[model samples]
Target: MKLKKIFLITVAVLSVFYTIGCWDMVDIDKRFFVGNIGVDRAEDGEQMLVTFTFPIVRKIAGGQGGGQGGGGGSTIVVISTVTDSIHAAARQAAMRLSRRLFFEHTRVILIGEELARDGIEEVVNFLERNTEINRRGRVIVVRGKAKDALTIKNEIEVLLALYIANIFENRDICARFIETDVDEFMKQVHSMNGNVLLPRLTPGKTDVKIGGAAVIKKYKLVGWLEENETLGANFVLGEISGADIMIDIPGYKYPVVFTVTHNKAAMELLEAGDYPKFRVKLEVKGEIVETPEQIQLAPEMLKIIEKMLEDRINHMVLASIRKLQEEYQVDLLGFGEYLSKYKPDVWEEYKKDWENIFPDAEINVETKVKIRGIGASK
Candidate 1:
């Protein structure tokens, strides 16, 4: 009984030792959170930037009208710089900042519209190679100053960094948090004829919103894609499902909107002697989210809606494709990857003359649209 009691006491002591302490715990007070990072194109073809929205012990709002008072005052800071590169900018900008710079907690990275227009690969490549930057961080192309996206605030979110992350994480029309990490982006870049799309952002006087996407071809910012075009691109790339489309019909008081609940698409290459033919097969099913007036879902009306949806999807996809073909001369659709993987023999033949073959390849697209319901009309 004595020996058992002694053993029990020792076990209890050891458990107490293990439970009460953290060996190398990092305190929240000791660290700083990065809200948003900005990048601009320099006159010398380098990157210049200003990182905005730094974290404070307590939340803060700046201005003569706004002072550090009450439970909240000024919790965020804005420190900026014009540097040769992003990492260098971070170090140089840190000199002006009160706290030490760290990227481990950075949630949003914004590239200025100008820098993106010239090319984003230079900056993005640096981001990818850096060991501190994680693949999960959300990236955006800015319409104006990248810093403004971070600094504009009057108590909208507790922390602008988190708010930016939440917008990209989940929620609304013109909202797509579709996962596009650094790895996948680089994969598309490395592919010989692959293209990539980056979600874009814009800051208004009141709020910020998703501003479509930037299309990248061969690691270069070829152009910008509108909302409808991005929807079509998502369909082509199979990046999303359950999206909505609004179409304005003549004589109709309001635009007819369709909420696409299901979509699947694939492309196949057919041999055509010295050349090859391409077939794009797409299947889409959607619910009638909103329709102004009593536009009944009659057979004819449904057929017309189907045709409309098909035309919309097709037009957007074709426009993007043509942009890639004529103006950009780069494929973001991974058509080459598809060929390389499935049709090895064709890839072997086409690889030799892909540039010559792509423009001349006969391409066809077929779409099937199904309208599941007409809301209350059902």
Candidate 2:
């Protein structure tokens, strides 16, 4: 009888397990996966113009619908809607899309220049609150219309989002563009006193260029950093992985290119008085990539080359700091953070007015370069 009871219990458990069904499961074929999202200012000046790019999975999987439409079978489709909030914009887009919209696959988020300048607090809040959106989604500010970037004809990647997303893969090679994600930006906005640097993307004919950066001060876009300026900021932040430096050789009329192999920067608080002073020292190691004519790879010659590279780096670093001090007056270089961490007493006095005091602070840059190798002896 006990054996019979055990057999009956086993059968009942098996029946319960087999009877369960996917009550809340949604089919993959019934959803539109968003690859990219663009946010801009609406024509009404009050609402937001949101753009969504959805990739056609059928064409991507080499099934059908390859170049069948008027535009010759595009890989992705872009749709725009005007709404007061991101959620509202998503709902508005759903009215036209044949399938349910999904954001779990989103790779990039582009913000229009005007909208970024006005402020990105609302957009930041939306991304932070949305659980469906991936935290790794890239965040960038487009120089012009964000929608323009979304509509670009990308021949490299099937989706423009992937094209933009792949640019950061080579960040270690140049360090001109920063990779800012949704979570990273939100953390900076909340912890950095609303100061952050977001990568800048400019759309071109049939392509898009991701370089430089947009400077955000107090949660508003104040200005932009060119590629060189961006590199300078990276130097101060000690984020430089590799970069190329071109300097005019002393006697030669042509410029010699030095490819940085290693780079580091150190900050020293010289004084913590009413007018704090700081000194930044940058150490760089590079290899000669290109040189004009027959150049001697002697120690003395390397010294001259090293000095020239040092001066050039000093100028670039100063130019970046000048823009921050005079043009934007924003400390996006972590000068305030440094003071707060090392010299807390000094920071306490200037914490209330760091923005104003930062402009008056004395900061200096010093660079040292070592030429390790000259490619191939003649």
Candidate 3:
């Protein structure tokens, strides 16, 4: 009887605390949904332009509302202003908005081209210090206004913010390039090497949209990888997961498209004191998806396709390596990290002239792609 009475007393006290305390205190009507954030430098000194994307939640429905063509029905509201800091801007937006702005669900953060060209260190510092933000969020570079990109709502998604988020999952679109996450970019920035990459989204006047991976050197925006160049970037870095390539097989007038389902890259570090040369051995295996040019499915056709695929992959990989090594002068591939672990003393010396040596360093790319049949049919 005494134990029962004590249990009842505890339950009663806990229930009262839960009901009266801060539990579920935030009012839904007083909340502004934050789907994306865009950061750039303002015209004023010691200021920043922060843009937030707000979704019109009323347009969204349940059940039939979430079908493939359903979700992208809502509209997006973009607010941009200059503030002393990000938090200050957040506070200002909150005051102007009907409800407090909530950011726990932000899908992406965009950095404008102007800001990227100016060096992303200060902006990155702000993101890192904020306790609410993490690295899983995808980061992208906008050739134009980052805020304007968030305002775009033409894509087919349940939400405008989600539509932009889906752009990051485009493996078929940019299979070769690694879809960089916020955390991954931070890891690169934290490293002394400062090699990072982000997807660049170019929104169109109509409903058209184009996205490709952009390479960023330690603090500065260097260049970009388009179409096949993006594929080569993947091959050289060994970040290939699932990519498709079109090659012209011998004896066949048209080209065939093959999808690489699995691939692995093996790196071999050479002896020290040399210009840090490394061998990249690429192994790719995939089945054919389409072939407009068919010369009959003979052993010769298969062999030719295999050889062509290997050559193209190798070419693209080498091109990416050459561009990174010769043009951008950024070690976004983490080659320096590989060298440091395998050859520490060498990295210590090479560290000083890394920017100088990056272009001159010799990178040998050897690739082998096995082209399987075009499924059951051609």
Off by over 4 Å in 1: 1-27, 43-47, 50-52, 60-74, 170-179, 192-195, 248-251, 272-275, 352-356
Candidate 3 overall lDDT versus native = 0.74
lDDT string, candidate 1, 96-133, tens digits: 76656667777778877778777776666777789877
Tell me the lDDT of model 3 at 184.
76
Query: Runs in model 3 with CA error above 4 Å?
Result: 1-24, 43-46, 62-74, 206-210, 250-253
Q: What would you estimate as the lDDT of candidate 2?
A: 0.87
Candidate 2 at 284: error in angstroms?
Answer: 1.5
Q: What is the lDDT of residue 157 in candidate 3?
A: 66
Q: Largest TM-score belongs to which candidate?
A: 2
Residue 344, candidate 1: Cα error in Å is: 1.6
Question: In the order shown, what is each candidate's alpha-carbon RMSD?
Answer: 5.3, 3.2, 3.9
Question: Residue-pair clashes per candidate, as listed?
Answer: 7, 2, 6
TM-score to true structure, per model? 0.81, 0.92, 0.86
Best by lDDT: 2
Candidate 1 TM-score, true structure as reference: 0.81
Residue 119 CA displacement from its true place in model 1, Å: 3.5
Which candidate do you rate higher for TM-score, 1 or 3?
3
User: 2 or 3, which is superior by TM-score?
Assistant: 2
Worst 10 residues of 2 by lDDT: 63-72
| Order by TM-score, highest first | 2, 3, 1
